[model samples]
Target: MLNRVILIGRLTRDPELRYTPTGVAVTQFTLAVDRPFTNQQNEREADFINIVTWRQLAETCANYLRKGRLTAVEGRIQVRNYENNEGRKVYVTEVVADNVRFLESANREPASGGGMREEAPQSRYGNQRSQQQDPFSDDGKPIDISDDDLPF
Candidate 1:
């Protein structure tokens, strides 16, 4: 048996982070992915997918991800059932993300003195990255990356 799913899309809203009673971090968010084909009316359609992250990755995602930011999510599709307030069974299908990649950099604040990445996104492990749109430089250019910065 095999179960896997991968998607690249923009965030429909900011990820909501919370901790369990044992201090386990968790985050939930929705991703808006456009369909490859347009509708009959010639308008593109999008699918809103639910994503869930756990542990350090959850914290990283909540801290760095924001609405409208493009991202890639890799995970398994999960379906669970629960009882609602009216005593009715409700089923939810969501992606349990194991890996997430930030495809866009956050807008930098002008007050920053250096051309450093203000909002770097990391994985379960901490990683720092920066791109175009610097606040310290007048041109707002992306800072150069050293070969050492690449994780291979």
Candidate 2:
């Protein structure tokens, strides 16, 4: 049972942050993804998708993400239904994001005032060391490694 979805698109609008009754942070936003093929008029079309993030990730997204910023979202497709005020059953489909990445650099600011976070996200290796202190830094020089260091 595998349920996963990955999408790369520009945000249609700024993220809307909200809190639940338990005080947990939640954010919702819409992503405008361009379709691969063009329409009859040869004009490209885009699909608007709803994205939902929870917990600390939600707050992070709310603070850093802005409208028209390119982003990548990885999550599962969720479909739920509820009765509207008219008593008609309504179904909603959205992505419950587990990971959200800002594809564009913070230096590139849109017409809107808000911008992304200044600091880059750390690598999976945990703490990020300065480039000058990195032993594996690529300085256009060949790296010296012994055969013993090569697992192959």
Candidate 3:
């Protein structure tokens, strides 16, 4: 069985970070994902998804990410049942983030006597080499390796 989800969207609001009773860091936020197709009026639709991050990733998201920041998240979908104040059963669904990637550099305030510089790239998996240029530049292009050339 496979249960996986990949989403690239903008945050609708700033991440809310808090610590559990045991001092475990946790963060929750909503992401606005635009639909691939347009509506009847040719307007793009968006879905607000709830995401939860834990531990170090949670702290990083809350510290760096903010409203309208584009982000890429990889995680699994979870559903749970709970009781509300009126004793009604409620079903909740959310994404439990395993990893998150900041997609854009935060705009920095201009420094005196200098132009604005791009912020340094940061990632949970260390500084990732920027692939913004062309993630699949080699696709359908000439390649030196062939199936028969494989050692396996």
Q: What tens digits encode model 1's per-residue C-alpha lDDT throughout 47-148?
A: 999999999899889988889887788999999999999999999999999988776667623323332222343644656656657657746567787999
What tens digits encode model 3's per-residue C-alpha lDDT throughout 24-98?
A: 999999999999999999999999999999998898889888899878788999999999999999998999999
- lDDT tens per residue, model 2, 1-152: 99999888899999999999999999999999999999999999999999999988888888778898878788999999999999999999999999786766555543333333223553112224365666667699888889999999
Q: What overall lDDT goes with each candidate model?
A: 0.83, 0.81, 0.82
Query: Which one wins on TM-score?
Result: 1
Question: Residue 26 of candidate 2: its Cα lDDT?
Answer: 95
Scanning candidate 3 in windows of ten residues, the lowest lDDT window is 110-119
Candidate 3, residue 143: the lDDT equals: 62
What TM-score would you give candidate 2 relative to the actual structure?
0.73
Which candidate has the highest lDDT of all?
1
Quote the lDDT for 26 in model 3.
98
Off by over 4 Å in 2: 109-119, 122-152
Model 1 error, position 91 (Å): 0.1
